[model samples]
Target: MQVELGQKIIDKIKADSLSPKPRWHFLVREWLVWMMGALALIVGAASVSVMRYLAENSSWAVQAPYGQTFAGWLLLSLPYFWLFLLGLFLWLFYYNLKHTKRGYRYPMIYVAGIALFGSILLGLAFYTLGVGSAIDGVLGRKAPLYAHVFNPHIDFWSAPEEGRLAGLVVAHVEGEDTFRLIDRKRGEWIVTYNPRDDIFVVVGQPLRAMGTISGEQSFEAVRIMRMRPGREYFQRFGPTVISVSGSGMHRNK
Candidate 1:
């Protein structure tokens, strides 16, 4: 009687084990693929919109205000986001091949291919913009310079009550190494050097400053474009002045 009871218990355990269990792995894999695909579609749409807006607006610089709109965000997020999706897809594909008997590897590969293609395209788009310049600056290929300069005459005591005062660097400040530009009418405006490209000027040969200005300051030239380093040529229409203030300078330690 005890032996029969033991056999009965074993049979029950086997039956329970043979009962179908939920395929949690398959469900998770499907969910991940769906989420990644949705993100890719959204980013793709945003990229198209930004590209169109930029094309229509000729004055829109890569560092312009509207540059960070939805389109810009999409371009910036695309590569990394898609690469993440690709990794997920690859993992799911491998898991399905190993554990599940389903022939879903091909579908996973297809999804990964789409993600890879999107990442490459978005990366290319980003590089075409000022991203390349930023990378160059990071690698020390280009020296950083203050984009805007303030006139030297304007004193902070009697600076403009409203509106921005900015100019190009006429000389470097002795102690601070700051660029000195004169807002001849207002006085002198001093802008400190910024390290990051985000708030700072774009990285290039001589560097350019593009930002807004407000408050009182001295500035002879409203804006100076692309002032070359160690050169004294002023008002030659060399580069277009971007803005009136050093508000665009960004510094990150």
Candidate 2:
């Protein structure tokens, strides 16, 4: 009876033309899974770092005058793009890890926990290396909408009509009180100020003006809050990450 059953199994295999897949095929598939999972984990780490960068650099102390509650500003200032990337990569990591050999043996909680821990660990390391600011700058330059959407510096200064205008100081005279500024809205203005206002204007500085519009393209700045000098915005976001517009400084005679 055993012989007959074995013969029947052999006959079924012959009839179906069944054959084993090459061992190398399985190896390649497993390798691919590992590669994808690793890449996903790396990207997730980057997202976390950028999130940290935004949280650290945002002007949380100044939102009160804008009538924005802490929760409201917090929501607006979030890096939505990075948040999306993190979620997408985390899912990818989990999916690829689950498909790996013996991976099914682990519980979902275990797999997710691994992803979370790895992101936190690598994210801190990347932040230490300044990857967060670098990536944010690149994205801000290449994708201008990146600033329009989630940049806290840009969002906070968007209320120009409310006497809040912010931009990079594109041009200024040596030892002079007047300077030319290009704001985030791509509006260039001639800014007149008083030196005794304790305001020092310099080229390539991100500045917030507390004044009212005086002309079609002019501003009479009462006092300017000058942030640490940074690279030009709109064209290129620098350490300050304030997006604005304008080019080539013209000496207004």
Candidate 3:
């Protein structure tokens, strides 16, 4: 009885193998797999671009002049949409590849690893090409969420009475130790510098000044430094940092 059962199973397999398969079936499957891969790569790079954009524009660059912690910086990056999208695309990549021929031979972990690695490599290339900045510019102009989600909370930085102000320096006040500073919210402040510190103020530079709010739109800066981009962003949004309340400010005296 066992021998008969085995012979019957072998004969059925042979019969199935001899059946003609539709030529278009394989072609369609291959096409779908390729399409999914292409899409996965696109979204993967887009995710990286989002991170790069936020890193460039975050307030930490303006406030923290010195070094910052990596883990802290990573925590601040949560609100941005890219990190979520990256994970989503990676999963999609794994799903698409799994349906392809021979894909089942590899474990899910292997597939996911390959997807993540490919995405990261593609993402870096997109960031280097300024794809992230271009996307941000578009979103900033068209999407209100751009400001709502990614922008740093301003009430903390607007503490003019606490001797701190954040903004872009739009102009110099003649030969005086002052320049026009525009905060992320577009609020303008008069930033005065300590003459002895030799702090340089250039027009249109992003800056954070520490002192007191002298007027409705004025702030006095006792110290200043050229803002470095990525670190400042992490400082502003990082987890341990509840508010950007001059936590990174330095005194020149």
Candidate 4:
């Protein structure tokens, strides 16, 4: 009888050891959170790279300065904003998964609270960054303009003749700063600088001008306007009529 009883006890122990254990919902939840965190990190890195590239290379030689300014605005507002949001979500997801598994059952009110708090922080940050400046420009509180300056450092074209004007300011506009120029025949043309008065170019400075027929001209009226430095002297709605080749200045109208 003793031998039989010892064998029964040993069998019970073996059965207990071999039996399948119940799944821990918390472990699964933690794994999912980790996956999400990895994804967010990858996306954030990609976003940073793209934003940097756009900020640096978005414009032609003359347009580079203005492009950089606009890129700064974008970096402050869009890319960072999205990155913060992603981080917030990742944090909340992790918190929920961790706390819930620890046998602490809390309502989702905590998560909602956290999200609200994060959004408020993001709003405050945006307000501090001069995003309001863009809004003000739209509201007409300030006139927004873009300026491009020629860079003598880079080679833009393959043709030797085209190289003469490579670093020269090609086309500039004040009222319409975002205008694009295209060659109808070759579809190749250089972008010139278009600086805003308040932002890039200063007042009382000679503005540079270059054209296909006209080599280049430096004039005094090129002084940046106190209020609208990038705007042309005439303040016309369309392209201004500045002297391209001759000593005389004439309006396109």
**Number of the top candidate by lDDT?**
2
Clash counts for all predictions:
32, 0, 8, 12
lDDT of each: 0.38, 0.73, 0.61, 0.35
Candidate 2 residue 187 Cα shift, in angstroms, is 0.9
- What TM-score does prediction 2 earn? 0.74
lDDT of 3 at 114: 83
Q: How many backbone clashes does candidate 4 have?
A: 12
Error of 4 at 142 (Å): 33
Ranking by TM-score: 2, 3, 4, 1
Error of 4 at 174 (Å): 32
Model 4 Cα lDDT, one tens digit per residue, 37-131 = 44544343333333332233223443343334655534332434435644665455445444544424555666545444544454445445533
Ranking of all candidate structures by their lDDT, best first: 2, 3, 1, 4
Query: 95-136, model 2: which lDDT tens digit per residue?
Result: 999999988999999999999989989998998898877777
TM-scores, each model vs. reference? 0.25, 0.74, 0.62, 0.26
- Which of 1 and 4 is the better model by lDDT? 1
lDDT of 4: 0.35
Question: Candidate 2: where are CA atoms >4 Å away?
Answer: 1-9, 12-18, 150-153, 192-202, 205-233, 236-253
Cα RMSD for candidates in order: 16.8, 5.6, 10.5, 16.0
Tens digit of per-residue lDDT, candidate 1, span 1-253: 9999999988998978765557997688767756655555445433333332223212224324433565654443243433444456445434434333343545766655554555446545754664433432332222222112111111211123322232334444233424545432424455444433322223211323344343344222233334222112122212334333334433222
